[model samples]
Target: MKSLISRLCLYASMLSAIFWPQPARAYLGSFEEQDGYRIPLDGQILSTFLAGDAQFYLNNIDANGYTGVVPLGTYPNTLGDGTHGADLSRYNAGEYGTNHSGPGGTAVDITDNSGLWRALAGGRLNEDVNAPYYNGSNFTRDYVHAYRYSGARTGSAVLNLLASETNLSYAYTLDARDLNGTAPSATAANLIQMAFWLCPSDWDDTDTDNILGISLRDAMNQTVFQVGYTGDNMLQYRLTGGAWQTTSNRMGTAGWSELVVILDTVNNTAGIAVSAYDDNTSTLASQTYVLSNQSLGLDADALTGLQWDLRGGSLSNGAASFKNYFDDFNFTVSPVLVPEPSGMLLAGLAVIALLLQRKRH
Candidate 1:
């Protein structure tokens, strides 16, 4: 019986080692990890410091004159082609980076409205290229830039596929700040919400179910984070219906910012890191948020669902919209150190030491 008990103890120790946290790591939108250690999405991507200016395009279409959105087929993320009418290849040139004979450029356009809604999930801000932007105080050169919008606004998401085979993922942007230079003043009238949706466990991979979003809510008089919403940002994320959690000051820089989430399938956790643009002029830094909510967790082993969403709420001034700008959006997955319950392991060791001491006495 003693020998059997010893074997069980040995098994428990092994299990503890396998499940205990290895280290504490926070992955910004540009970084990720898997199975331990640091791992980045290698190869010629759209635009990363590692890409060496090698343009990021899907290289599978001829979308040159296709105006407006078409039915989404399968081009960027699945096993098919994007062609509903007028030879889809013509439209691919602007966004897919393959309009001309070859494929390599700094432009991406997706006007198709079908398939999965995550085709552009891994897009980065102009890759720190010939990027320029208006930094509220002044228009800065050689800085990442984006299009800002504010007002009674509405639009459709044109992506269709955002499945990640590799664990490496990304979500880059120039910045997410008050385009009108509005300060976080009393009774904010404007509200904004931006997020990447992930399908839930029960929903079909093709169904858009879950969402991870950052919202500016006038109702709460602050910005809030979301896990699910009523088809739009105004609803906010809730189980059946309730108030959402809030974050600190929203981003204020117009440099390089991103939202990175490391999906750990085995452990059922996602490490979230959000970095405001890191231009030397901007003092805002990166922050980390842990996503243990069911709606925010990984759908399957792979990121099978992704939806890019942005919406505006009514303002205190009764304004419908406030100008906002964001570019260089990317969302991929790699692996990194994740937090674990190590205190228990240490306590176990202390108990063993006490037992040994008693035996010796």
Candidate 2:
């Protein structure tokens, strides 16, 4: 009789398998895929998603994927100064004093997938050509890990959201660290931030006004969302007339923190979340806040149309300039999840039966 019960437990589990919780998936690479995979940047994601690169990039589409919290790839781009700069006048990757294919300037051997990308937001760009990785960077894995200087600001290996992207209706987060390779000091004037800007076929520096993002205590208040990196990482949101509002501090610790945002366009609200953590494993002491109809007339459709961007190094303010790194960059459009109350019960029963069998053995 006991043996029959064990078999029945297993059979019941199989019957109730449909209720198994579906795992989450990465935004860039996952839209209709199976569950429990928050970061599914695999073969299909690499070859299928549009790739970009300015400097440091891994060779071959097969070389593309995620490393821990960071995503790597060779994103091919035709606009601006990419890893291979065809025209010198456009805004490039990192910093730039001149054109490509020359001397007395920051130069590197270019590839079909590379280009002349200048440093971003008024900074210098750098990359390692001899190696496979072009820029220190994607989610099909769209999550990217960027540097404040070399392999980051100086180079770009981006995934094109135009080809593979989700709407603003998802939970997004960016985990950041100071250049020291650890949590940022709350006292330090950390200048790093992630910007999402309109990627009209013709994107350039002039589009700065169209970009907005989150950061750690931007003294200049570069964007609407920011924090001072203070105790609890106080959250701040900019108002219409440049005024600012604050909320309970986010991220319990100081070293690292995540900036989370969930866009509710239909209701004109933005649910922002943040937390402190290490090694990109996960964030700690998370917090969430809701902002309604406070977008200063900015359209949510435009926000959804923007591309993923990583930038640091002075946005032109020397005081703000500091080395920083970011990881687990995600922009998603999550669907309403279905429940499995019966499945949960069956799963528990299965576990209990397995344990009983072990004890009997």
TM-score of each: 0.33, 0.32
Residue-level lDDT for 46 in candidate 1:
30
Q: Report backbone clashes per prediction.
A: 43, 44
lDDT (tens digit, per residue) of candidate 2 on 1-361 = 4435434543343223223332221222111111001112322221112223222222222344322222233222322234432111122212212212111232233342232222222211122221122244311222122211112211222222211121111112211111112222221211121212111112212222212233322222223233222112344555334644555543322244556444422222234444434323443544333342234333222131111233322232211111123333333332222225676567778889999999999
- Candidate 1 — which residues are off by over 4 angstroms? 1-95, 98-112, 115-242, 253-257, 277-281, 286-301, 312-315, 320-322, 330-361
Candidate 1, after superposition: displacement of residue 297 in Å? 7.8
C-alpha lDDT values of all predictions: 0.26, 0.28
Give residue 20's lDDT in candidate 2 (0 to 100): 35
lDDT tens string, model 1, 61-105? 234321111112212322233221111111221222221121234
Candidate 2, residue 214: Cα displacement in angstroms equals 3.6
